[model samples]
Target: MSEFDKKDVPEERIGLIDLMRTIKVVPLVTLHSPEEAVPLARALASGGVPIAEVTFRSAAALDGMRAIHDQVPEVTLVAGTVHTVDQARQAVEAGCKGVVSPAFSDAVVDWCMGSRIPVLPGTATPSDIEKAYDLGLRFTKFFPAEAYGGVKTLKALSGPFAEMSFLPTGGVGFGNAREYIDLPNVFAVGGSFPVPSKAQRQGDWKAVADACAQARQLVQG
Candidate 1:
């Protein structure tokens, strides 16, 4: 691989991607309440998944991230559903190691690049992927994976973007997760099925952990 290839991404950025690949799954979490943040993070860690892509979909996102960062510091946290540069900055301030957006936003992507923070901007089409490549990013999030042809789409993309790898999210769950993970072009899978909604809402950490464990097994199998 050339120095500019995915294998040659900056050392710090490589570490982030390595962590994701090691875990094989990133929990796409939406905090319903700030109080559940620490416990949820711990549950994920106990379940063998220690990473979170906390979306900015809810109001508790920032405080939730802070609680996780301050309390359960072991879980690798990243911001998700980010639509603006301000959200990206807030995520970083909340101790997130990186940021993820549902769509490609120049301002957000540029801010992370300028700040030297690892980011995975969403790309659902060939044009979007090319734009990400033009920005010198080798890793990107493939959003609405199932909606836009899922595994078949990823396989087709491999031909044109041989050097680029993806973190496929949306419409991904236990039934189809292994298929995505098994793909050579996918680095990791992102979705919320690992942290069951009822488990999180009722503070049933063990149930959450069990779900996560099952997800980990799916990837291993």
Candidate 2:
């Protein structure tokens, strides 16, 4: 009955946990410098996919993630390729909305539970999916999507994992992103195609923005 803080409420719904679904596409970017973070994030935000899954594959990842969170406050940032508990801790500290791993990690999921952070544990097999379900997590990341049989595998899993939802990434590009993203079982899609590696390296914010705009049009059109 008393007043409660919104921060105290940890979102649980797949639809809510992964706000990327509303936008349809979530860019996975890894900028090398914090200075690039603001512009890159702004580009994506302004372009329409105002959401990004910034991964921890670089030394600048944490600070870059924080820079985006601070500068482009409207852009929802999620941490991706999280492989360690230390990385998970640092990610939340940097203001990431959720944690995504390339592979299932009980430790990472456990850390999220203890810290009250939304964690989209990755899955590739039935056992992996069931592990997430057993952890009371209905949402997950389907990594290496293309290499793992992509849509065919997702369809087959949908029979038993009917209630589950996925955020398929890895190999999800502009060409085939629509196929996986349009699925009823998929809440959203994540990939670096929207923010190309060369573009990021060259500080080409406009290119990133244009890609985001095109991705938005594809999802809407």
Once model 1 is optimally superposed onto the true structure by TM-score, how far is the C-alpha of residue 11 displaced, in angstroms? 2.2
- What TM-score quantifies how close candidate 1 is to the native fold? 0.97
Worst 10 residues of 1 by lDDT: 1-10
lDDT of each: 0.93, 0.83
- lDDT of candidate 1 vs native? 0.93
Model 2, 119-149: lDDT tens digits are 8888988999999888777778998888888
**Each candidate's clash count:** 0, 0
As a whole number from 0 to 100, the lDDT of residue 133 in candidate 1 is 92
Q: What value of lDDT does candidate 2 attain over all alpha carbons?
A: 0.83
Which pairs of residues collide in candidate 1? none
lDDT of 1 by residue, 105-197 (tens): 999999998898899999999999999998889999999899989999999999999988999999999999999999989999999999999
List the candidates' TM-scores in order: 0.97, 0.91
